[model samples]
Target: MEYIQVLELFAGLGGLHIAVNNQKDANIQVVKSFEINVNAVKTYQENFGHDVVSNRNILSLSTEELFRQNVNAIFMSPPCQPFTRLGKKLDVNDDRCNAFHHVLKLLPRSPNIQYLLIENVYGFESSKMRDTMLEILQSCGFYTIEFLLSPTDFGVPNSRLRYYLLARKNKKFTFCKHDHTSIVKEFPYCTCRVKSLNDQASICSNCQREVNTNISSLVQQNAGNAAQNSLVNPGKLHSYLDKETDIEQYAVPDKILLRYGNILDLRTFQDSSSCCFTKGYTHLVEGSGSVLVCSRSVTIEEAYKVYNEFKDTDSEAALKSLRKLKIRYFTPKEVERIMCFPDNYTWPKDISDKTKYKLLGNSVNVHVVTLLVALLLHS
Candidate 1:
């Protein structure tokens, strides 16, 4: 069988690379990846062990190199800042948006590329970038389908809603006959997300009811099934916790526990699930995401007593001794598990915890893209 050769753009730490490799398809090979982040490149190399990751700016990516690789599939998750609501909607004006334009310029020169998959923040669907990308793909002879999807929709605990586009050239090796305009595929009904207790027998992460259909069971059951299983199985928040962890490090800071405690997305070990973990996760708790409550053996009285003493002192130094019986940020490794990366996935030992979190935040949910890759193969 001829191998499916792929090129990854904005390949942050090889999320797409991992997806292509993980996909249960026939003989898939990622020929090249273009990324500018040094740390991300190192991590990608560690995970994928491929020298094909180029440190060169994608804006300067050579079409000849892509052609040389004889690439048939293109997988990209471009920077989303220019189209995000939190950032200035600079669109084409933003220098960050230039990389996407560069990709458009490369497409015409690489007509052999049969499959194109692109992902971005949800806001991208309504932005100028969406219109421009659609136009370019259509002019280049491809039919496209778009959607808004979340990892939860596929059964992972975390909810990371993203916009995606899947495009293909028609069988005649010319323009797809399925109209030049974009076809927005209605997202499938997500039965996998944890919901209110009344909605189903399955335990709701938010409501903590006994479930005949357990979230953890759903994950395990789907894990071994073929690509058709669609593991979007609903699971508990604690479904992601590593079997063991260093509680001392991830424990909530005394300062944060004291002031913004109530607003924090704190969940006990058995809670149904967590919020979306953004790049601002540890830095900001409000809407930035969830923290798992530790199951330490300390008494509630002692924990509160320690908290009060730490609060009374009102100093960073006092916080050093403030050991609560509960709560910690989901470790970077745990986050990786939640995102469906393999157990063996590792990074450089020198990489900081902050960079680890940032890389995961910047990366795609591999399982989601894996399903998309399967679709690209079968479609």
Candidate 2:
């Protein structure tokens, strides 16, 4: 009657917890989730209806007590700030990385841990912390498999490349010590890229009506029977799109346009891909993400005509002439849909829109996580 007891550390918004809970295996249960972000904790509780221990920071968590509880598995996505390319490469020196370091130490203290999964941003695999991580896992007698995977490879349109390490205790996982390059992971099926409105209208030779590449179409390419099989194509991305979303509120403000206006990413209703979004997606518009435009897709060259005209003028002035594009921010619901959260997934009603964007940015891909869970647990 042994059940799977897991500790989800640095569990932001319970993304890992949700994935584990979604596993078909009836024995798996999250024993404790450690999170310090109050907003994330609240959002996790709202959606999960479970209590998480957040009394102290992760480093302060009582691992000695956890050992007594016989926790067998650990799933962690510790802070990526110290390892991210966007920030200074402080690695283990950064205070944010201390929690992850503490977890590494906690593992030896908790000997019963047989399975471990760690995820982080792309740059994490190359950072000095990675070597330390590999050393710790090896010394702990855990066979480790590492890979860099993106949601796009799994038939989800978004491009978010992250690092993952799966390790099992006392397992003969084969690996060459000299080989350190990460392989770009791929799935069995890759879907057709969703063509944007302008790209479709302008490039398509057929004058007839086109399909509004919805979620099913995006997933249908790869998943003949997603309900029964094919972990990659979890075909429900469009379910969470807000039918009555406030377009104006999500629209980028004029001030935002002044700095980041020209770099618009007008995705057609049928588009299947997008750039990685960050916590500052709302505030930092340029490299953060693409927006959905309601009007005919104007080529960047065409938009540049308007942009060049108002390069010196206010961004609002430039936008005045470019109103036909009908640009708007991807609604929070849409963002959630892109992240592959279930349609019924709910966040705190009172949370700020910025917070919503941040939460979604910080969260992991549900499909990707679920697939990894199924593979590792064989559920």
Candidate 3:
């Protein structure tokens, strides 16, 4: 089998890189990665045993320099802060937002590059940046397919909804026909079905009833455990009180209350999925942080428990047990698992926990990426 050469831009901690590595048919090799954070680059290098260019502003790399490696595909997930609705929505004017422009300018120089994949927040679809990106691809004679997908759709418990763009230079590439149907069929594990706002409202009464029934059962099973072990109220403790408490006392907060309170409520369980796991956990100061006021954030072990329970059986017993564990948040390895990264893959052991969290938070869920890549390669 012929292998595909990949150059990953804004590689972060190599989430895309790991997913590409998992491709069975393609000889996926990440020739280079451009990252601005030194710690992130360090972690990337440590995990992949590749030379990651650190602190190198992506705009500074010329088109010739990027194409010098003769890459066949380029995969990127740019910093999403500019496009996220939760943020400033700075769009094209944001310094980070301009990175996509740089990528577009570089693409024309690489004729051998047959494929391009970009991942970002769902808000990217509406942003001016997305329009410009589509226009650039069309001008370059590439066809594109865009979708908003979540990790839960891929059988992962977390509801990480992101925008994914797959572009191909070949005229034969049809976004509608290129195995997206089979991709969805094969990955029924994914909770992120492509549905329009109209279709969501059009669900028949029977479908809605079934959905409600399932949700109610899930809530009753997980809510109690989540309340007893996972939830916490941060507002109750003054900042001064946090400092005064010993590390041990602060590590574990009061059992999370299910009812709404001034904390990270366990009510998140009642909803369909968990919040996007971000590097926010690193900023948490057991007692003082604003993110979550629990004994510890959910750990990798716990995350795995949730994933296994949700994916394998959707069993209430498993979820209840997972809620009771009192570990600090999941390790990077565990996060990798939740993201469907293969167990044998290597990660940088030397990097700080903060960097790992940032990398995982920024990465594309491997299962989804793998499905995309397979479709491109086979189609």
**In lDDT terms, which candidate is top?**
1
Please report how far candidate 1 places residue 302 from its true position, in Å. 14
User: Per-candidate TM vs. native?
Assistant: 0.79, 0.81, 0.66
How many pairs collide in each candidate, listed in order? Answer: 8, 0, 13
Instruction: Report how far residue 149 has shifted in candidate 3, in Å.
Output: 0.8
Which ranges in model 1 have alpha carbons more than 4 Å from their true place? 171-233, 295-325
Question: For residue 279, what is the lDDT in candidate 2?
Answer: 84
Indicate the residue-level lDDT of 209 in model 3: 18
Residue 334 lDDT (model 3): 48
| lDDT comparing candidate 2 with the true structure | 0.68
In candidate 3 the C-alpha lDDT for residue 115 amounts to 85
Give the per-residue lDDT of model 3 (tens digit) for 1-379. 7667888899876777766765544677778888888777776776777564455888887767766777878999988989875679898999887777888877777677778888888788888988888888878888677777775554345557788877788645442444532222222111122222233443324223112222222222322111111111111112112223233422323233111112342312123334566655435422211222233455535644554546446545544444454323344554555555555656556676567666677777776676566545554
Model 2 agreement with the true structure over 170-246: per-residue lDDT tens digits:
86444223243444364322222333333434222322223232322333332222221222332333333567767
Q: Per-residue lDDT for 1-379 in model 1, tens only?
A: 7577899889987878877775543588898888899999998888777687888798777788778888988899999889876789888889998988888878877888878889998788888888888888878888677777886665566778899888887733121234425544433222233343246544445334333222323233333212112334456656567888888788888778777654777666665457777777788778777887675575444655655566557545334333444678999988887777777889899999888888788888877776566555553
Itemize residue pairs with steric clashes in candidate 1. 154-232, 155-232, 155-233, 205-272, 236-272, 237-272, 237-273, 294-327
Query: Model 1, 219: alpha-carbon shift in Å?
Result: 9.1
Residue 367 C-alpha lDDT in model 3: 61
Which window of ten consecutive residues has the lowest lDDT sum in model 1? Answer: 222-231
